[model samples]
Target: MLHDAKLPKTLWGECIRHAVWLKNRTLTKVLQGKTPYEVAFKRKPNLANVPDWGAKVFVSKKSKSKLLVHARIGRWVGFNDDVEDFEVSKGHRIYWEDSRSVTVERTVVFRKDEGKVRGFIEVEEEGVEVGIEGEGSVNNPNNPANAHISNSPTSPETPRSESLEPV
Candidate 1:
């Protein structure tokens, strides 16, 4: 997995740990299709939060200035055993964040060379509205009706459904 992801040899330990984690969750012939994790934990392991090995991750940086970049770029290394968090490698340090704390946007960037692909993962604020140049709002799927409501004069204004004042 490390070699395929083009990760450095120094991260061999992290790669091995991740491999073991995956192996435990995967079915084996010796176990008659049941995973080792299922046998030990008495339940199926959840793979929903698993990230691609060595994929670029944009983690939210804590205590940052208002004008500074909100995220720090890192490499997806593995998972934390104690909590449901992702272990990311940033320079010489390893940072982990609660899985439920942030929203993720994943995208695949294709290289000029065919068959070469790279994954980019970004963590963004939940419920935040992002607007395209002229395509309208890109995020906030919950409010689809407001998608077409833009800043242009021709676009109709959207009425506020909620109040900011204390009730």
Candidate 2:
């Protein structure tokens, strides 16, 4: 599934780790409808800790430097059952580069939108194609093609600006 997803080879280890974690909890007819986790531990595995594999997430960092931000932008890649922590990617550069940015940390924030990308959602408000303004104002009704369009500040459509603000 990792290869089919077009994920890089360096991520294969992480993907395999996640797959193994999931496989242990899956039921099989050969096991008399018992999961490997249940058979080995004599208890049902906790599924609550499991998260979406490729979802965007942020990892919290513990540092002494004031310049360091509280969190690092990353993606959830794997889980380490030994330490009860998640393996998150600081960036894709860690795949090929010498950077050892991948870390196991319990403090992680997953995107609220689930399967969709964070910051922006394509909502066809009143059938208007809300997009970059070409010439006239994006919301100008003079062009029937442009209907009641709004990238409302109150809405999640403009989450990027809100996130950049000093916390």
Candidate 3:
């Protein structure tokens, strides 16, 4: 939103600062004497291929899980801001389950000259019936594996209606 709202890109700056601080205060002192750059370099060299913070990511599918083939690509948002999640561009087909986070890429298909476009997704209207076993819903039911939770369930334990709290 900060990007789309045309707001100054300061949000990303604060995010970077927080990340540097968090690195120093991790649960373990694994990098006790080493600097972040040193530790990162030790782990892997030639970080040239590293993409932009919010560029885009498309994690390939594995044997144990189903893939949202149509949504194979997703924007590379920042480290998650609200939750422990890394930041990601807000849009459809973004959801995390268990320890796995999966998001489909968001793209606006537009014809430059004619200004005609279509939103494309990996979902299939006619073909393989891909079903995922999880507690979530797909934005486009045609693409089942792209998971999302519609809303919290209202149970007898919690009131269905919300009452305003004193401000």
Candidate 4:
């Protein structure tokens, strides 16, 4: 996972920890098709918050300067099980935010490769229509084209914007 994410070898430990977390949530034949997490916790894991390993994340920053950028780019590294927070890496440091505190944006733009835009994913507020740049949109959730993304559970509480203030 570390190599696939194009991350440095120094992040191997973080990658391993993330991998184990994912493994625990995955189904296995050894466990009779039940996830290890299910066996231990007696409930299905909520995978809605999981992001791609090392994917670029826009972490909100705290600053009084009006001209300063409100967000900083970081790499999604792992999850803090104790606090139920998402872990992000900025430089050599790791930051954690509560799952409820993190807002999942509908639109995601992929990075350019070889001077060409890779593609993007967009979800509308009303009915969802997921589509790639060259591919047609998929309106049906059961369609294979929409299999890559899943709808997250919504809450009545409004999403709060908080700074990724370093400790």
Candidate 5:
């Protein structure tokens, strides 16, 4: 699904792990009509916490200001293992000065109809050249390589290569 959604390679493992976890908790033939989670815990798995991975989500505003924005837009990343909260990340960081951190929040609203939020941006490693081969590569405007391929308004006749070559 990650490849189909045009997500970056870096996210493949995370996506796969989440998928596997869900599959384990869901009914499957391998479990002999019982879900692995149910068999292990002697109870049905609570799937309500599961949200669409990479989906656009709105986290409830926790600020005390009267002019509250109501919610902050973020991308649903995964479930928090130690809590009931869902893990979410704000694209482009919360601010230039703030460290990029995933916020675990219980109040989340998924925007399923708006399409999956595969808004992950790739930050180019220092000294790595970005751009098509032999094009005097520079740092991509969309960050490492073309992170906006899936979000681009125009679709190319041929799928563009995503591999990066060292400068």
Candidate 6:
């Protein structure tokens, strides 16, 4: 953890964040199929509803006292029907590695016991943790983003980085 270990946060809370990114990507890759939500709803289903793998979530109660039901919302970023439990969290900020730095955190649950009958997820956008690091290390001399413009580069942009290299 970036905290318990008294880790002063890596160059950017490096350990937990880095490990999570890899895990999320791998999960996204593996569950690239029709999820149960989709099968139940009878459509391909968009994954835009799911939150980050371990972001904190708070389930509300009628009690005025501030006893928040803390949990993590851990779902594979893509689609998967087999998993039924939405991992609840009282923990962290969520992010999208593939979708730029757009982020979200689960602040409250509008429907606590709606079960499968209730069909969708929603969350509030609070503190967004932006990953300052680019797609790769810039320190590497061979890092393409830092490459010099060349005379004979392929494609339209010579020595242009992948962002400009195009698909």
Top-TM-score candidate index: 2
lDDT of 4 at 119: 48
Q: Candidate 6, overall lDDT? A: 0.38
Q: What is candidate 3's lDDT per residue for 1-167, written digit by digit as tens?
A: 33542323634553354356455434345667555645643542233432333333444433454643533433343333353433244332322222335344344221222211223323355644433433442444444565454445565465659999999
TM-score of each: 0.49, 0.54, 0.24, 0.50, 0.48, 0.22
Please write out the lDDT profile of model 5 over residues 30-137, one tens digit for every residue: 888999878987888887645666666777777889786888776665665543432233221111112334556767777645452333333355644334533333
TM-score of predicted structure 3: 0.24
Whole-model alpha-carbon lDDT for candidate 2: 0.61
lDDT per residue (tens digit) for residues 44-114 in model 1: 98887566776656656655579887666555666556333332321222323333122232322222222
What number of backbone clashes does candidate 6 have, counting pairs of residues 3 or more apart or in separate chains? 9
lDDT of 6 by residue, 19-123 (tens): 543444332333565454444445554444544332333433346556754443321221221234323333234333334232333344422433222222333
Model 5 regions more than 4 Å off: 4-6, 46-50, 83-101, 112-167
- Per-candidate Cα lDDT values, in order, are 0.57, 0.61, 0.40, 0.60, 0.58, 0.38
Alpha carbon deviation, residue 29, candidate 1 (Å): 2.6
What are the per-residue Cα lDDT tens digits for candidate 2 across 48-162? Answer: 7565675567666798998979877666676655443322332322121235345566677876666543333457566544444444545556666666555456645544354
Best by lDDT: 2
Give the runs in model 4 whose Cα sits over 4 Å from its true position: 82-167
Q: Of 1 and 6, which scores higher on TM-score?
A: 1
Q: Write the per-residue lDDT of candidate 4 for residues 1-167, one digit (tens) a residue.
A: 77876777777777887789889999999999999989987889888745677676665667799999877655666655533333332122232333312223322332322122234343446554445534344545666777976667565667669769789
Superposed by TM-score, candidate 2 places the C-alpha of residue 21 at a distance from the truth, in angstroms, of 1.2
Q: Which scores higher on TM-score, 1 or 4?
A: 4
**Candidate numbers, best TM-score first, in rank order:** 2, 4, 1, 5, 3, 6
